[model samples]
Target chain A: MKNWFRAAMAIFWKDILLETRTKDMLLAILIFSILVIVIFNFAISPTPKMIGFVAPGILWVAFILGGMFGLTRSFGLEREGGALKGLLLAPVGRDAIFYGKMAAMFTLMMVVEVIVFPVFAVLFNLSLWIPWLIPVAALTTLGIATIGTVFSAIAMNTRAREIMFPLLFLPVAIPTIIAAVETSGVAIRGVELAEMSRWIPFMGAIDAVFLVICPVAFNLIIED
Target chain B: MDDKPAIEINGLTKSYGRTGVLRGLDLKLDWGEVITILGSNGSGKTTLINIIGSLTKPDSGTVEFGGIGVRARATSIRRFIGVVTHEHLLYEHLTGYENLRFHADLFGISSADERIIIVARQLGVEARLNQLVGTLSHGTQKRIAIARALLHDPPLLIMDEPESGLDQEAQGMLDGVIRQLAESGCTVLTTTHNLDKGTAMSRRIAILREGRIVYDEDLKSSTGADGVKKAYASHSGESM
Candidate 1:
């Protein structure tokens, strides 16, 4: 157990350090997300009365798009640089590499959300500056990143990497994304924490199910 | 520290679809020995190594480490082995140091920071440790890959063409590492198409031809290098 933790921390920090130096992934995903949010704002004239009604959809759309971009960068770097084979040869447990990558990607997605939510709130004119949405955001990102990490590994091996990620990912990410959007919507509408219970539980359930499946599936995908 | 043979295989067979790769192959490798496998392309040299490394599943066979079945105790048995292939398996975006450290942590082998520095020096890659592997020369990257394999001090080291991309100097360095490993009582299994280098480095050599061992002999034999070449040529039906 101690060894696992140490190995996880090593992989986690290594990725963090790489991201810190490059900043390419964060820059691309953030710029792409903000552009999408800005385009949505311009395309839809969300008046004060209509803003709250559309806020959740906008947030969900932004996250789904942001996550897709994040997943591409996550595995693309490893695949392009030929680092995937090195990771495979390491004496570490294959599952640890899977979870470590999921964790790093999950953190990156959350950071993107943290940055985008405020920009989104102002653009949609929705009072979404709620404290409770933090956990909801974290849960949503975790679910998407977990499943996305696995699919990204799969897509990384394919001939059409750019097009394959979304086709393979969006369908599978639906349950988690919908549950997240619904819960965040409930929160934005100033629903009580207790009243928003169902969506949160649903999000947790989705996360729990995929988290267990992703690690096992990842081993099968990388073997080729 | 037991003196058992590092690897023993019996009737190892692997097939993809209707085609077979390894066909009831049998091998035995003992400690302090360096064995080189030579074969024409598609003769199942890589498949055999992959099975022994537990990277690929064999259709039917038994691989044993110190006489224990590979399938029954893969994890514990794996702790005794390491592998390096044409893939060099280093994360290109990460620095050489990061790659080594990650593998060290994975094997749960704790080494002082200085020890990592020492191994990097031994591989002539200490200066490149901070550089991203993607930016390093192929020879330098292969050295780092070799360093990662040695990080855990496994008793059996399996390398598939470790000298493939290396320059003459780097190849010489690789030979030194193999010899040093053997001198230290480690069993080394390597694959190469360079017949001269293979014969020079190994005490016993095995030639795989069309998924079967066509030649297995020791250095003391007077069969000469041409005899092994002709045997492989006749068996593979491919001109060298």
Candidate 2:
């Protein structure tokens, strides 16, 4: 058990080091997300009432698009040098690679969210300072990263990988995205946790199902 | 670790979408022997190595390591095998030292730093250890790939076309490294197109053609490079 955890952390650390040097995923996600927010800003009216009405959708869209970009690039790095084969050839368990990659994606998504959320709030002239928003974003990103990592691996070797990832990822992600947008809507309006408690359980359910299923699916798909 | 054969393949067969790669192939390597498979492109050399390395599954037959079937104990079998392919398999963003260290951690080598140093020095990559793999030359990258494969001291080393991009000096270094591994009782299976180098480094040579090993010979009786080349041409039906 200890060895498994150590192996997972080693993969995670390698990703962190590589990202620190290149910043490819982070930069791409950040730029694309910022562009998304900027486009939405111009597309929508800036009235306070208008911002409140559309803030959740815009915010979730930015997060999802940016997070998806990060997910796509995550596996691309592995494919570039045939590093996935090297990882698979190692003595480490396949689940360890799944966890490590999911963790890295989660971390990357969180970092991007942390940066993008405040900028989003400022741009939309809204408030997202509630503690509820944090958990909502965390749970939602966990679901995205979980499912996205699996599909990313699946699509990594495909000839049309860029087209294939979203086609596979978005449908499965609809439930989590819906829950996130709905909950974010409540949080943006400063509703009490009791009022949004219904959506929290649904989001948590999605997270639980995927957090269990994706790793197992990843193991099966990665093998010959 | 015992008196058993290091690797045994029995009637192995594989194909992709009606294109056969390995057709009823069988080979065996006793403990501490170095065998080089010589073949042209699409001749199933990589496919054979991949199956034995447990990186790919065969459509039929069995591969055993130390008398244990690979299908039932893949993870355990992988721990004993080190693989180097045509692809360097090193992360471009990470330094050579970092790449080796990461693989060592994955293999659970506690003495990773020491092992990385030793293997890197043996491959003469110690001086370039801190350089990013993407910025290094192909020869240097191949050296690091070799170092990564050797870090765990796996008993069975499998390499596919390991000499493709190497210079004469690096090729000489590779020969020495393979010889040293064999001397230390590590069984090595490598595929190469260079007849002379392959014959010189291996105790046995096999020519793979049309998805099967058509010619297998011991270096003892094969007089020199010319003999091996002629034999390869006759078996593979391709001029060297």
- Listed per model in order, the count of residue pairs whose N, CA or C atoms clash below 3 Å is 2, 0
Instruction: Report the Cα lDDT for residue B149, model 2.
Output: 91
Candidate 2 per-residue lDDT over residues A159-221, each given as its tens digit: 988899999999999999998988988888778668688999889988999989998999889
Report the C-alpha lDDT of model 1 over B95-197, residue by residue, as the tens digit: 8988888777767775546667877987999988999888998889889988888887878999987878899988888889888999998899998877777
DockQ of each: 0.47, 0.82
Query: lDDT tens string, model 1, A1-224?
Result: 67667767777776776787788778877888888889989999788777666877888887778778778878777765456765655556667888888899888878888888889988777665687788888888899889999999988888898799999998998888778777777787777767578688888888999989998999788764
Off by over 4 Å in 1: A80-82, B1-4, B222-226, B238-240
Per-residue lDDT of candidate 2, residues B177-220 (tens digit): 99999999999999987787788778699888888778888878
Worst 10 residues of 1 chain B by lDDT: B70-79
iRMS values for every prediction? 2.7, 0.8
Q: List candidate 2 segments past 4 Å from native.
A: B221-227
DockQ for model 1 equals: 0.47
Q: Which numbered prediction scores highest in lDDT against the true structure? A: 2
User: What are the models' TM-scores?
Assistant: 0.93, 0.97
